[model samples]
Target: MAWAAWLVLWALWALRGWSCLRCDPGSMQLLQELTGPYLSRQLRGDPGLRERLEALLQRSIEGLAELPIGLPSYMGVIDEKTMGEAAAHFRRAVTRIMENDYKDGQLFNEMMWSLQALRESFTSLMARFQREVFCPNKCGHMVHQFIDCRACRTEIYSCNRGLYCGERRLQVQEDDDLILDCALSWHRASYGAKSYRFYRARGNSEEVMVTSPDAFLLKKEVTANDSGRYRCEMLNTKGWVCSELRFQVTVTPLPGNSTPLPMPPLLGPLTLPPSSHPTPLGGPGDWTVWIIIGSSAGLVLLLIGGCAWLFRRQREVPKEDQDSPGGQLNT
Candidate 1:
């Protein structure tokens, strides 16, 4: 019945523009020729009234189309009062338009049928909404943080403790999977034996979903594309029992070890290269490189020191021999 009614609304929507275009004073006969055969011989509405009602029907279709198909469990709850107002306006318009000769005009009867179809569509959608959406089960206000621990990025769901997902934002290293771990007791207690369906929403489009009878292992191998606001929902068979958590996932690069060293310029006659220039032995940067360069200088210093010590010793021995005559001169 819902499908049939939906089809009727679609047909009405498709024809609404044509009905308006043809209702112009010049194209009355053309409109009659087009729609007169389909509308039964039970409504003979006035021409002006018929035009007004057609316009009203167009407005009705517009309003219905604006409504979201399924009541989003997160935001934009269906407006029952607004829907009722539209239905009432439609009813009053129909009542005023089809006063006396309602059962003799093709156009008037067609309008009435379209109105009924619109009403049915509203009823069906509202019933489904009440059964499923008007009442949602659990959860909200979550921001989870995940750190890349070499192998994987993981975060544990706060087990019925607080509303915030975590203290920090989700940080995932490039090419690691994000794992969301949570205890399932809260949902189990709320939903009882009913099955669960998981839905994830990102940005402003329709949510992508998957179904599981129990707690689903949530692991997403993260990439640059995975950075976004993510909402995870757990819903059950009755649709009344639902739980959701909202969070943001951000991906970052791996840790770096060190920065690259700068290259030395080529040598010239007037200006020597960095290699040709004498470098200080001790410095803050490149200690190991400096030690390698100063090794030869250390050996030369050792040889000069030994020569000076021998010369000093010879001078001291000569002074001692001159002073004492025969102390000792061992070759």
Candidate 2:
């Protein structure tokens, strides 16, 4: 914020004037007696006083040296740390004057009182700056869900994620009636925007029209007619305190009759042999089909070779039996 920088510059100027005033020979002599040897010797003369004051002021400026460029509208650039540090400096000055006494009692009292006032002013300013600038009192966040279907209107639902305004702090309440308001705004680009409230209550006994009286969900499906900014207001039991937030939602209806998405083209027609069905890939000429045929042919050849080898061995065994011994003719 440019205002923060301006405030810091003004503070530096004021501190410079104060330091110069304290550098006067008469004033320094009084401080010499009040603060003792350390402050008098180490922080003597106008230059030394200015240097010490500048060092204190520099602590705050250095803390906020990195300023963001083009910060978002929802975000703030105020430097809270710098303000806190400046407030601390004011408080310390107050303490220094109050802790010691000097020869001129009236002057010492007056200086202490002035420092006290400055300390209080800076402390209050820091708090107010943080509240109004850094932490804005606005509504919380909103989350919306859109359902896709072909109908008269699209189904939409949204919820308020927060209630209070301070940065991330929740505003807690009990037995509160939440009043929701919806307004329609057309022509998103135009500077002239018209908004109309959804339902307004007239009598004390009359109730506001809501999709759900208990929950935050909209009672009816949001149609194209329900496009605009929506704000929710919460009222306490006594109707004394109220909290509110604003959100925008748009609902677009699909055509009554829509064409289906086209299916992907097939590689080729699937065909199979009369005895076997098609493979898992919807075709018989796949790598899996070839692997199955090769394995079956190898098994059939192995079975035939085993049977022929066994038959040849059986015939040779009978002939070997007849050749053995002296033979049947000798018997």
Cα misplacement distance, residue 210 of candidate 1 (Å): 2.0
Error of 1 at 319 (Å): 51
Model 1 lDDT per residue over 97-168, tens place: 445343433433555565565455545655654454343223422222222112123332221333333322
Off by over 4 Å in 2: 1-91, 105-231, 237-248, 253-258, 261-331
How high is each candidate's TM-score? 0.26, 0.23
What lDDT score goes with residue 297 in model 2? 100
Q: What lDDT would each prediction earn against the true structure?
A: 0.46, 0.40
Where does candidate 1 stray beyond 4 Å? 1-169, 181-185, 200-202, 257-331
Candidate number achieving the greatest lDDT relative to the actual structure: 1
Candidate achieving the largest TM-score = 1
lDDT of 1 at 98: 43
lDDT of 2 by residue, 1-331 (tens): 2332343355443342122222133433543443444334433543454344445444433332222322232111223343344445554564565455432334334554554566455445545544544324234322222211112122333223345432112221222222333311111211122222223233343233432223243334444444444444443233322344344444454546358887655777766436565446646568767899999999999999999999999999989888877556742
